[model samples]
Structures are given as C-alpha cells and as structure tokens.
Target: MTMGLPHGLDGTVEGREYLTFRIAQEEYGIDILKVREIRRYEAPTRIARTPAFIKGVVNLRGTIVPIVDLRMKLHQDCRPVYSEFTVVVILNLLDRVVGIVVDSVSDVLRLSDEQISDVPEFEGAIEVDSIEGLGTVGDRMLILLDIEKLMSNVDMGLVAADA
Candidate 1:
C-alpha cells in the first residue's frame, strides 16, 4: 500500500524563506513574509532631532513610514548613491509597517533546513546577536536576520507609537 501522500509532494522546501539585500559589500536576508514591498530609492521627508541612522519618513501610498539607512546601522562607510545602487525594502513589524533603506536588493531565495547553519560567534568586531542563521547558496553566503529582534531593539524603537 502507498504510504499517504509523502511529505512536500508539491516540491516544497521546508524551512524559512528570505529576501536578500546588500548593505555595503555584505549580503543580508530577512524573512520574506515581513517584507511588504520593494521600491526604488526616493528622497524622504527630513525629520529633525532624530537619530543619525534614521533617514526620515517617506510617503508610501499615503502612509508615512520611517526609513532607516542600513549602511549607517551597520556602521559601514557611506557611499554616494548612484542610479541603480539604491533601494528601499518595506517591512511589517509588530503590526507597524516601516521602510528600510539598503544599498541594493539581490533576490528572493528559499533556504531549506539543510542549507542553513548556525551563526558563528564573532568577537567585538561583529555582533551576531541580530542574526538568525547563515545560508549558503552556491558560492555566496546570506546572513539571515532576525526581524523581530532587529525591530524591537531599544535603539531601533520601530514599535514606539506617538505618545
């Protein structure tokens, strides 16, 4: 007798999925579900007295979403933006939506359980606390990020609503 319908008969890879993007020269990934949409880079409305990492807010289809510069967050040297090297990755966190500015978007990739490995503990040079895991794709490595922690971190304050 045939045992039920076998697992994942529809050619599905069981594991977390991510949308990879570039910050500086490194590659990073975030949960695909948390990503609302990706849009071309646009100048944002400046907000005074905010953190340097916060680029300000942007009008996303009418909603004002705060934008964070990934390079600044990662403590990387900022480069002058060119036509194609800028992009914005919209995120949905804690029922609040925000946009994160990144250098460029790579693509959406599926990382199976077998493809992901635990993140290595790095010294003071790099902090692995915000990283979920590491996924290897061919010759490239994608640093999977923990969206919840990254958004909720005290420094980010992404969930803080108007008082």
Candidate 2:
C-alpha cells in the first residue's frame, strides 16, 4: 500500500509514515520521505581518516554515497557482523544522499499524533534531540528518529555546517 503525508485543512500535519528497521535488538524508524531506496549490503571501498562506523563509500549509479553502519553509529554494537540479512537504507536528506547499514528493513508504518509520545529524559551516546518521539503500535514501541538532525550533528560530519 502507498502512504503519503496528510495535512489538515488548517495546514497542520495529521500523521506521518516511517520506514522501520532493526539495529541489533532495537527497532528504529525514520521519516519515510527521507528514504530513497533499500539495497542489499555490500562491502564499500575503504577510506582513510574516517571513523570506524563509516564503512566507506559506494558508487551508486555513478554517485559516491558514504555508508554509515547504523549499529556502530548508534553504539548498539562496536562491531557488527554483516550477515545475509544486512541491508543499506539510502536516505536523501537536506539534498544529500547517504546510506545507513541496518540489520534488516522492517515495514513502513503510518503513525498518528495520538500514537506518538514525547521522549523522556535520558543520558546516552545518542543525543535526545535526535529522537523525534516514541511510537506505539499494538505491543511494539518504536524509536522515531529525526535522521536529518542526527546526520547533521557536528560529530556525524555528514552534512555542511550551514545545513
């Protein structure tokens, strides 16, 4: 089924769709609009001076796309084993295209405001600001992420300072 962002007559957002994925044992979701495509995992060309989480860059249809291991980036795992289930989630954020390695791609979920709650205070490697909200569907709880903000954070160094 196709899902699209819907707005109220007053111009307020009604609900949003998310592309959910797994990283280790935890489940996370990102704005579906930010997702370009999902591709099977492949070893990227290694680069020098880059962080370990950055697996390297891949040539995608002539465009060089840097691949970041989401497990390592989120500190869920220091070193993740790439199995057959591993996949790359290509995201187009702020006019830049980047890919994130995920354990597996789950499903696209449509969540309403009532289904999402504010994130509680926490201290961790992941900045709380990067978490958009917490979504609940049935018995499953999802960590909704503001991927653009996370990738643009100074430490990530994926986007320009002005971005």
Candidate 3:
C-alpha cells in the first residue's frame, strides 16, 4: 500500500522514506509522500481573529499557505522560538499545500513494517486519533502521524479562506 505524491514523487525515497521531526521532546514522523519540503523557521503574516493554534500564513514560492503551530495544536505550553526551535514542514494533502510549524526537524528515517507498532491506548492530552502508530528506533520511539486524518480533521475551508 504505497501512496503517491501529486508530482509522481514516490512516497518512499531511497535511504529514507519517512520525514522525521520533533515536537517538544517527542519524535514524530509522516510519510514523505505528504511532505513537499522543509524550510527554516519564518515569521508568518498574522491573521487576526483566527484560532491561536493557527500561527498564520506564509508565502511559499508565490503560494499562500497556512501555518499551524504544532506545539499549540498539541496543547503544549508555548515558548519563544530559538535559532533551532522552529521549522516549517510543507505538506501536500488532497492536492492542497500547507505548512506546519514544528519544534525542530530531526532526520529522515527508514523503518520496516515490522518495526512499526500500533499505539497502545493511553490517556493523555495528545489526540490518539491523529497517531498512525509508534515506530521504534534503537532507544527512541517515533510517533507515526496520520497525516490524512490530521489534515481532514480540520476544516480546510476555514483555514484556506481565512488564516
């Protein structure tokens, strides 16, 4: 079950098939197929009256994209951005492109299907529905993100039309 990007970029890439990033102290990953590119942190144009979780919007090569603060979205404490504390991951979902702000990007990682495990039910502030699974890498655990659910769960029209 391989997913294909709009421009024909295979969801899986050689050497690395997953785009790994960080939110707070936890590691997370999304299928590379959903990722368009990664950019250094940039201040977005703030849109008044939008949700706080939606940081704002940014211009990417002439395309206006919404930017969501992962920290705030995850209900974590907001903090000042440091030189290495912020990154924008460009995502392509349902032919629409958007940018999400993360605490930092780690590295691309490749994991076999066997290496990925279903997330055990746990009580927490983080929404379990957005998690695809959990992948183990040595001593670390990577939370696999269900990009489709995350994107679809939000009202795209609201974000697209406003902030």
Quantify all predictions' global Cα lDDT against the true fold. 0.79, 0.90, 0.76
- Report the C-alpha lDDT of model 2 over 52-137, residue by residue, as the tens digit: 89899999999999999988989945689999999999999898999999999999988988889999999987899999999998
lDDT of 3 at 150: 68
> What ranking of all candidate models by lDDT puts the best one first?
2, 1, 3
TM-score of each: 0.85, 0.90, 0.80
For candidate 2, list the clashing residue pairs, or say none.
none
Ranked by TM-score from best down, the candidates are 2, 1, 3
Give candidate 2's error at residue 119 in angstroms. 0.7
- Clash statistics: count for each candidate: 0, 0, 0
What's model 3's TM-score?
A: 0.80
Per-residue CA lDDT of model 3 for 122-159, tens digit only, reads 98756689898898878989989877666666543432
Q: What root-mean-square deviation over C-alphas does model 2 reach? A: 3.2
